[model samples]
Target: MVLLLLVSLPINIIFHKVKLPSVMGFIVAGVVIGPYGLKLVDDVESVNHLAEIGVILLLFVVGLEFSISRLIKNFIPLLAAGGAQLTFTGLAIYGILSYYGVPQNQSILLSALGAISSTAIVMKMITDRAELETLHGQTCIGILLVQDLAVVPLILMIPLLAGTAEGGSSSVGMAFLISVVAVTALVVVSRLLVPKALSWVARYGSSEHLTLLVILIILGAGLASESLGLSLAMGAFIAGIIISDSEYSHQIFLDILPLRDYFSAIFFISIGMLLNLSIFIESGTLIFTLLAALVVVKIAGAFLSAVVTKNSSRISFVVGLRLAQAGEFSLVLAKIALDEGIFEASQYQIFLIVSTLSMLIAPLLIQGSSKWSLRLFGAGDETAEGPKKSSGSLKDHVIVVGYGHGGQNLSKVLNEIQIPFQIIELDGESVRRALIENFKVLYGDSTRANILVQAGIMRAKAIVFAISDFQATEQGIKLSRKLNPDIHILVRTRFAREVEELTNAGADQVIAEEFETSIEIFSRVLREFKIPSNVIEQQIELVRMEGYGMFRGISLDAENLRKFSTYLTATLTESYQVSGECWANGKTVEALHLKALSGAQLIAVVRGNEVTADPDAAFSVVAGDVLVLFGRHASLVKARKIIEIGDGACEKS
Candidate 1:
């Protein structure tokens, strides 16, 4: 165990720095320490046992992340794209395996494995690049979600395919039905009971006991599923989904993450231990041949499936490459086949080699998709090429730099308002999409003056640099200024610190998303006090005027800090509309004297379209009058109580 950890930690960290998945690093460490390699570990049995627990735990976490609600919400994509992708990919692989004279069961297993992609890897890349909400990213995720759901049934089919005593037709049928019932009961019970139980534990149990409770739930679910003749990992997944629906899911995920990552390393390494250098040496040709075949099959399968679902040819091709890699679950499936005596040592080694190679290269494929899409589908031009054509026909258009999330949203708004705009984007896919949507998008780096001029920089009403890359945005700002000094320049940056830097770079209006987002949070916090929208807007403007410099290096002294806090938490003025059925509806203002009882000052009585400010003692409370009351939170509650149920609900008011 020490040797495994010692080897894995450094290797994983180093590979992670080099932009490769840590799973690869752990697998490499395993290969180096295995008996066939360095003989550091004579046997990997104990690690595999630990690795199995990791699988169940991580799958449980995955289950928590993906609930049935999320699945059903994406049902359209699941049925249309996901279902098609699986069926076509499986058919393509099954046909090839059968042609190569593979056994029926083995071909079926391999085909299913070939059809799935690594959800973790793809999602990480998408999120890191901030593209999870993009059409391509959303489509990929929807399909991946469905593919993950498909794993449950694949595992269920394992015993049936293996033809064990439990795999008899009637027995398998009964087991399947029972497993479905068990899963339903588990989800229902979890929703109805897990939260209450956890709340009870939280109230009485120590932190350690709470941790033990979570582990027990995970393990208990696994045991239950296994007892019902289903996959323990799948049972754990169901348990995870139950917790996910509960309020405790987030805490449980945070608690289990460290254990999950450590054991998951061991899981990947177990697969790596299967890498026989001997097989590579003797059957190098055949192994690479199989590797090439695996990539081709998956890429083609994804592409064909996407095409059948009416995804554009360009999107289908790129999406196909993104999903070319075999997943971690594929190894799990392969392991089951190996343990079931369905695959010979040589066959398992070939699948293992192919799977690893695919995973290692999948990241690169996703990262380089823009360039590949350009070359493969001719959807866009190289960045060196400026605008495909002159935009002389359009006058005073908005020029958007970088067609990422910010640019996309800005362009969408502009297009909706019938504002003339042209986009300068370096990403081939973004350019293709823009053009497809009938926008005047140029394929070039905006930092280039020539590219900017070609995009009508001189005549554009405004130039917006909306990309996340700071250096690139700075360059674009400087270049735009040098060319058209009087142009309206708006720059969007990620960090609060970038606000001053971007402003110095000559932006007319600089929006720091981080601080602006903070403003939003503070605004919401303020609104909870019933502070008016106009006040919130004023506070947000104040933050912007100061460049939200507090986030950078600006500091408030103790007195001023207290003053600001007081303003933020000051007495709020709220208006309560008088209802006809209320006991205080027709009472005299002197009798109700709310200021004396609830410490709430009636600032105004807005009756219909007229306002009577500071009503005197002779005034009568009437229905249809909006009493604008001003007070601290506690006083406001009393004022509301006096108004809601009359003076009877309040101690004095």
Candidate 2:
């Protein structure tokens, strides 16, 4: 295992750096180290044992991410796209096999194996592209779920198809019943016991206990499934689904991810080890012929399914290509069939080569399929639901990079004040969110020059790099400057050290998170000390000047600067709503004397969205009134606490 890691890690990393999928690298490493090449690991028994556990864990993680609620909600695609994809793909293969004089039972089994698409590959592609929320992406996931469920039936049919199991149809039905019962039991146990157990264990805050418990549950469920004469992976998936909505799901994911990735590499490598180079070399022409046929059939089936399901021709084509590959389950089924003497050794070897090669090339195909489809289909727009964009006349617009928190706030204020602005967000989901808010957001990498141009960077008044990724920010700043040298380039960096680098990259102002955070901290301290506003302003300006002139373009006196800086400080004029039953509700302003009690002066009382500025001391503080108060952090907390106290409850106590 250690030696396998030694070869696999560096190779995968190298492959990833070259824009190739890491799985391919692991497979290559496995092929080189396996008996056929170096004889380092003569047999795959130990690796396959570990590999099975890896597959279980991998599927478990995937199940955790895929909520059952999501599956139910997306049932249309599950039934429509999934049924079409599987039926059409299977029929095509089965027909071809029958034409070649293959037996009915073997042909049916082979067609079933060929029809299943790789959930791992397609899911990874969608995740990497940040497109899980897209129409096509969701469709793919729903169909994949149906197909995964179909695997149980397919596996059951294997023994029956081979005529080796007793009781025939009854035995098959029994296998499915056991699987369903085991899964239900696992879910019930998880929903009832796991969350309670996790909560109890979490209170102690022991990482060791939390991690151990998670591992125990994963393995326990897997073993239980196997004991019930079902696949271990099936049980682990059920366990993951049960824990997905638990409070500790995120933590459990964090705890188990590294192991999943590592073992996943081993799993793929073990797959590669199954290949015999001599056989593949002898059957290269035949192997390529079958691979091409498989690819064409899978793509056509998926595309037709998606099209019939009302997905755009372009989207359907892209999705078709995305899933045009034999999945890991297909390999598992083929191997099982070979072991049961349902497949000849030569036939199994051919299937292995086809499956491996299909998976190897799937990522690359998915990457380029959109562009390929757009060219072939000549669809008017790339996205069916994306926002309509016409940036031809965009000018003097503020360009905000990243649609995250800071960017959202900036864009919100810009919209409220009627300032024209455009957002550049790489995440398709984020872009969709921004579009929902009516922001003119484009979905593409801001680091790309063309994408920036699409955002009207050349004609924009200023560009704000609000994203946390420093490298991408720096590259964007450089490119933006080259495009519009006079455009005000403002950058936000997480570190003070990067400020100078950002300035060098052509950013006019660089606000480092650490530096600005310190300013906020000290300014609050000064406010608490009742330091003169002028002195604090000078201090902040001096620091900013020394740290790369971050707070620029604002020429303000102490008072105006103080007002602006208050927005950044913890002590500010913030509003607190007085709910019914609160102690302060129905009380007179003089009776409460909020300024005296909490050191928070209520400047305005807003009732039913009507603001009474500087209401008299006798003004009644009624429930549903929003009190805009000004005070330090501690005073605000105290004021909020008083407002939240039930009417007369405190006095009665």
For residues 1-653, could you state the per-residue lDDT of candidate 1 as single tens digits?
88899888889889989977666677788788886688898778887789888778777777666566755555575467887888888998899989999899988888989898876566546644555434456567767756765666677666677775355556544654565576667667766777787889989988777778989988988887777655667677778877777777788888987887778778767757766788778888987887788788877878877777655555677678888888777877888878888888778877877787677677678877644654455323235665344546667889998787688899999999999998988655577778888888987666556678788887888999887655556767877887789899998876676788888988888898777777778989987776665557766765666677666667645665565566666638878898998767988788786888888888889988999999998889899889998887668777777877877667653
Error of model 1, residue 432, in angstroms: 24
Off by over 4 Å in 1: 101-109, 116-185, 206-208, 228-230, 307-318, 327-342, 366-653
* Predicted structure with the largest lDDT when compared to the true one: 2
lDDT of 2 by residue, 248-366 (tens): 88888888888888887788788678667888899999999999999999999999998887665666887789889998889889988998889998888889888888887887888
Which pairs clash in the backbone of model 2? none
Model 1: how large is the Cα RMSD against the reference? Answer: 9.8
lDDT of 2 at 66: 62
lDDT, candidates in the order shown: 0.75, 0.77
